[model samples]
Target: MIKGIYETHVNVRNLENSNHFYEKVLGLAHAYGQPERGNSFYWIGGERHAMLGLWEKEPAQVQRQHFAFHISLEDMKHAVEYLENKGIATRNFHDDDTGELYVFGWMPAVSVYFTDPDGHSLEFIAVLPDEAKPELGLIPWSEWERMHGRGV
Candidate 1:
């Protein structure tokens, strides 16, 4: 059987700044990293972690890369507010293909996309419902588990 996720690696331009963002801003702990290797790693929850590696290049070298983290509705709301107050820009999205996409009113698994201080595209998403909820935007994990699978 599968155990669990280990870590996801991402490249950064500034290891120090990325370290600060993941630690102070995201509240993740710095597990271990190698400056000589041009990489920094942050411990997320438990065994799960995220790696930030440093790289050097020109302007066009900055490509758009994005990853999403699942958060609860309340957390999502607070995060949106926090980012907005911090001057982080966020935009709303809608899907035309309801047959394939999930939505949660204004709350349907809301997502915010923005660049980190390093110009990396980072996204936070609250999972949306398979159907549109005009009033509520919360899609419980139980429902998602049934729709997707176990362990999600």
Candidate 2:
């Protein structure tokens, strides 16, 4: 009944900081926004499509939310390293069997999770081809890249 996501809105403590994070760190282009309304808009995926709106609000009023951005498999790897170089930490789904964080095999996607300046949970996810299945259990991004014969 529903199509793809058209836009997403989230409250942020500061528009400037959020803008820098989204624009510089996440590589989203700034579309446009109303300065009077204390809001900023970013373009994701394509130009003038898949919008992400940031509304400036008080810290107490900012509600934490989770959202995942679809990225290329190679880009996902670079994103993880990029975040690490910037001193940002990432996490994956916890695997009880291996006692480590691993990717979700069912969806065949490798994801790295982190938080925004406003404490909203965000993820960079790369969905792989259906044939890319693991033999034993969920694997890490490194393992996924290695199995596909591509990595840094």
Candidate 3:
């Protein structure tokens, strides 16, 4: 009976730098760590909702990955500014530093993308309460709202 992802691991070039990014910048709680073991754990969305493990590895050994954190639509609306204000540049799924949200009509979800200090892609996303429109593929948030007749 799987309700959600419990944990995910990532390889980082510098453990302390990654820890600062996760713990200070992003505000994830430090669950625990073993510097001698070259790893640390962080709690996301609170102590038990999800956990993230960081493994310190050689830069060449690190492989970047992408993941998203679910947030409310209200928060999603201002995610770009929130992250940018914190000095994290946001982007669209296209990898462009558009500093705006993108909508995946198929899933009917809106998201803003950014990266960790290690260049691992990260996202803050929120699903919209609307019917799927697969034909729309991926589009700007404004277009999504317009098409959905909730134009803002």
lDDT of 1 by residue, 51-149 (tens): 443443344555756666666655765665677676676554442222222334554465556667766777667764445555645444345445546
- Give candidate 3 regions above 4 Å deviation: 97-99
- Using lDDT as the measure, name the better of candidate 1 and candidate 3: 3
What lDDT does the true structure give each of the candidates?
0.58, 0.80, 0.89
TM-score ranking, best first: 3, 2, 1
Q: What lDDT score is found at residue 92 in candidate 1?
A: 43
TM-score of each: 0.61, 0.81, 0.92
Write the residue-wise lDDT of candidate 3 on 1-152 in tens digits.
98989999999999999999999998889999999999999998888879999999999999989999889998887787889899998888887756456789899899888899999999999999999888989888988888778863
Evaluate residue 138 in candidate 3 and report its C-alpha lDDT on the 0 to 100 scale.
Answer: 89
For candidate 3, give the lDDT of residue 132: 89
**Evaluated with lDDT, which candidate comes out highest?**
3
What lDDT is reached at residue 10 by model 1?
64
- In model 3, pairs of residues that clash are none
lDDT of 2 by residue, 1-152 (tens): 88789899999999999999999977899999898999999999989669999999988989999999998877865775787787677766661344233567667887778889988999888887646465636777566667668653
Model 1 TM-score, all chains together: 0.61
Q: Please list the residue runs of candidate 1 whose C-alpha ends up more than 4 Å from where it truly belongs after superposition.
A: 1-5, 47-62, 94-108, 128-152
TM-score leader: 3
